[model samples]
Target: MVERLTRAVLAAPRTVLVGALALLVLFGLYGGGVASHLLSGGFEDPHAESAQATKILEDEYQRGGIPVIFKIDAPNRDVTADPVVGRVGKQLVEDLKQYDFIQDPVLSIWTDPVAARNLISKDKSSTLVVVPLDGGEDAAPGHAEDLAERFGGERDGVRITPTGQGKVFADTNTQVSKDLFLAEAIAIPISFIALVIIFGGVIAALLPLAVGIFSIVGTLALLRVFALFADVSIFTMNLATAMGLALAIDYTLLIITRYREEVAGGLTREAAIHRAMATSGRTVTFSAITVGLSLSGLLLFPQYFLRSFAYAGLAVVVVALLGSLVITPALLKVLGDRIDALDLRKPVRRALGRPERGFVPTEQTWWYRFVQWVLRRAAPVMLITTVVLLILGAPFLSIKLGFPDDRILPTSHASRVAMNEIRDDYERKLGGEVTIVITGSTDAAVDDYAARLSKVADVDAVTSPDALFVDGRAAAPRKSEDRHGEYRILTVTSNTDPLQDSGKTLLANLREVAKPDADVKFTGTAAATEDTVASIYRHLPWVLLWVAVTTFILLFLFTGSVVLPLKALVLNLLSLSATFGAIVWIFQDGHFGALGTTATGFITATMPILMFCVAFGLSMDYEVFLLGRIREEWLKSGKTRADSDHAVAFGLANTGRVITAAALLMAIVFAAMMASQVSFMRMFGFGLTIAVLMDATLIRMLLVPAFMRLAGRANWWAPAPLRKLHDKIGLSES
Candidate 1:
């Protein structure tokens, strides 16, 4: 089937090229407009209790719109009592009321003194004025930006700074978009240079870049299509561009290298293209499938943040595979001998009068020598590599997970600065507060429940309409009006940061405390974090199962060797464990503070899962590249133990340079994301770079050869029934 498809593409190169060009133009148009449809936040599980509570609070209780807070400071004066401050505050309130998006009766120091006590800063020089907007969280950013432009400045001896969730969201989106463009600008040129050095020809170098561009454009188009049915996170754009370019470069290197070798072996152009398609093309197809399956695990998580990556990854992999298998072969067939015509390095070699070295199996290459050394002392090499991998992975056991917050943004950002101030100054009221909604209960029952909640360890205070409870006792009559009909709301405040260990313990205690005759639901920052973590773990096992089962099946078909697939799985995991350890060390433990990042002492909960899928799939990709060449050599030689050793050395000699070059290009691409101001992206960039480097060098070069030598003929063993099944349906170039 692959040969027939290659023949058809080769038979109509011009037609295929034209059709691909048209599709590229169409997708480019669609991709250009995708940013407007993307979402800024998706950290919470949509079906979790916090999500349900948030929805009820918004729809049923009319608790909509994020607060646009203005911190007004007047030096050396009580802002609440100063004539100039009072006049300005009232005028600000009246002006806010005039805007249609602003909710009626904006809360300020002059409007309500009881609430104002919490809003006022401790020094009595500054107070907060909050204006609620008309829309949900998504609309808050735009509204906040507009309001900040109009009202965020000095007036009547008071200086106002606008800061809230909406403004933070807007700033983060803008920063990510900028970072994405910067990453592309840096990665593409570096990749091209690396490709040039690897291929030693300008035309050969540009082919992979062209495939990369096509993959990115097509993936963006697919993302736009998916956005019509579901919310896609803006972060997905970053992942899409990086994966598209990396995979395109990887697939193109394998295909073009094979085609060049076949041509140099005196095969006709058509036959070379056919053989290349039959082998490298088939491998590229299965590699993309394996990658797509790995990313599909993200779809099982409830957060759009994870699902968005799934959408972006699968789209890019599919598009990259098509570019490699179909369009690339067609281009190769058309280019023929001219593919080597643009050899910029040829002049230098000619000046030195050195013979050109083509990619053929030889004993003199460093890859062959290295494999021979490993085979000679296979046991010691394997043991040392295993110990190193395990030590690097040890830090992951101490990793602490948390949800992202304003801290994800750069410290210089206005929203981040404002949020830091709020967290420091308003610790009692705003920070670490748990909101509980109780339905189908009487007001007395709700009050009693609030009292019980206040008794929980670490609870500072509990506020309800009926009474204010402190240390499980009624301290004062609550002056706030009842905002309940069939349900009541209670606020539980604590001293610990909600995203930390103490806060998690407090949440558990709150859940453990009993409430009578009410359906109690908790929603707030800490509660939401707990729920999101729970949701991810609940579905993580299924995702791992799916990836494991599908990857094994695909590898079995690709290699017709059961043992090889298991070995690949173990090696990939070892490489990933080292990467995870590096992440925990640098990002979580703050060991690399000189790298210009602030460590929060905790890793983002979603990052490990996302990184595992991406890095593991990429490792599997390189695995297939090496195994395909070894299998080809094994088939050509006799299937004896000596033949297996010969095949290992021969395959490494032929393909090891290509694997290292591809891995270097991929690492460079991911490393460029380290320039991102966001901490998560930096961690992602660093972790992936380490994973690629380790896989390409240690695992592929040293461990794989040694393991193959040890396994001997058993490397190709399979059950009789499975062997028959594989022979009937296996994919092979021969």
Candidate 2:
């Protein structure tokens, strides 16, 4: 198959090259244009949900625009009718109007009057003003920052602080943008270096990133076209670009690495390229299926965040596979022997200039020797590694997952500043507290039950329009008094950190409180956070289980041995776990904080699980690539397990360096994402880097051989029934 592909590509190298170039160019142009469009204008402010809601609220009530709470502080938390305080407050409102982001700031006590009780704080020091948003739906604080600066950082005699739903959205948009871009930029260069080390040739090294970049840019174009028809969030685009780059580099590396190996094995350049396409291309096809299927499970959760993410991820992966499987093979055909140009000229050349012929046992083979020594000490090493991994993974046992927060930022960010500021100023309002909702029953007993809740504490004030008021946050509105009546609402606040407690205590309390009331349902911020975590966990088993099954089926067909498929699964899992643990330790467990973010005990709510399914599937990709070589050797040697192991070992030793290089490259690409200020992305970069290192080092080098040695005769198992089926339908390298 490879030979055929090689022949065709070589027959028209220029044509093949040109065609691939054209495809890449098309996407580049389209993506650039689309990206330019987005940059030129702006997407509607999804963050300003609250600000938008305020306007709607005002319109409904026939009142004014949403009121902005002005926090006026004297040296102390004093609110008074002090002449200076009143003058500062009045001047502040007037000065705020001069800033365009501030629609209109009314100063007089008349509009928000003392009778209206618009004085939010006890000391007549602070007051609320009604302000309309100045721009269209896209208006944000980022656009207003310059204007604010122009008017002087402080307004009037008062320090200007903006807090509300609109401000929150503007803040979220700014921070998310910084974090994601930082990670994306960092990922590319690091990944490229890793690739260079793997391929030993700049051309081979650059290929994966090249393919990834093209696909990424092209995907943007594709999505732009898609965007014309459906509503796609800008956030989705960020995620898709990331996934595309990572996978493109990944899929490309898989295919190109295989192609180079085939070339080194002495196949004609064309044959090598063709064979690589036939096999590596097939691996990509399966890989894409596995990734797509795994992501599908996210849809069941019903959050647009995850739902849109699923679609974007699936699309990019598909795009990545197409670029590697189709476009890469053609390029390989064109490159032919030139693929080895650098190896022959540089390190290989330097080593070959000696009488030893530059052929020395690789570190993998050397590590195999170390393993032999370790086998004598295997019990201790195994026990020690196991203990450490357990200790590393233990944080997950107490892991607390919760809704997103500013802690994920670098703390220097405005988002973090704003979050901290709000938390401090409004502990009374329980600002940023998750909303607790009991939806099941609207029975009058609900009010009596609610009274039970207000008494349990963490209830700053509770108001039930029909029900009695106990303390917690402001008066609870009747779920029935409005459409919200069918749903009773409870506002809960805790001094304890929600993410750290894992939100379990609050959830438990809510459940316990609702138990006596029949048909009780509780939902709120803490509830939502807990539910999302539970939702991830609930779906994880199926996702990983299906991934394993899919991998086994694909490997079984790819390699006619039931034993091989099973081996890949076990070995792959070990690699994944070790990698995950290492990352957890480094990023989540606080092993290294000076360089970047410390892990948040629990990684971003969904990433560890996502990495598991995707990374494991990807690890299977490299596993199959090299395993195929070993399998061929076994079959050729008349099923002698030892001979096959040697062949496998030799193949691994020969290819081991490149595998490590590729892993390093991909790790670099992933690590570059670490530059992102966002904690989720930062953790992702760290975790991915660790996973690649584990696969390329421990699993591929040591564990694979050790496991293969253990499997011995059984390692080549092809059951009679399956063997017969294999004979009928299997695709063999031989």
Q: CA lDDT, every prediction?
A: 0.85, 0.58
lDDT of 2 by residue, 1-734 (tens): 44465456567767876877788788777765553222211221222322233343233322223223344544443444556656766766666665554543343353544222423444444544434454432444344433333332353455545443344444455555665567667777767666666667777776788778877777777766755654444455565666788778767776776676666677876667677777666656665765676565545433444555566667787788767765677777656667656653476666777542343434346644554454445345555554554564554444444455446666775435544554554323322233343445654655666566666645433445353356422253443232243454444444445555535575566567644444343444445456666666766676667767766776777678899888777766666666666655665567767246645565556566656655775576568656765665677676675575566665566556556665666666666666766666566666666776777776776666666666667876887999888888876654
Candidate 1, residue 658: the lDDT equals 89
Candidate 2: residue 665 lDDT (0-100)? 61
Off by over 4 Å in 2: 1-12, 32-153, 163-172, 175-204, 222-267, 279-301, 307-309, 335-388, 425-429, 432-446, 466-468, 471-507, 514-521, 579-591, 594-603
Once model 2 is optimally superposed onto the true structure by TM-score, how far is the C-alpha of residue 51 displaced, in angstroms? 20
- List, residue by residue over 1-734, the lDDT tens digit for candidate 1: 67888888988998998899999999999898887678777888989998898777777665635667787878899886899988888888877876777754466778866566677777778778877666764576678889989998898668888876677767777888899899999999999999988888888899999999999889999999999999888888888889999999999999998888888888998888888888888878878888899889889888998999999999999999988877898788788777887897878799999887655447888888989999999999999999999999999889888888878888898778877777776634454778888888887888888889899988978998788898888888875543567878888877778878888899999998887777889988889888988888898899898888889999999889999999998988888988899899888888868156778778888999999999989998888888888999999987999999989998887889889999999999899889898889888888889999999999999899999999999999999999999999997746
Give me the candidate number with maximum lDDT: 1
Residue 686 in model 2: shift from native, Å? Answer: 0.8
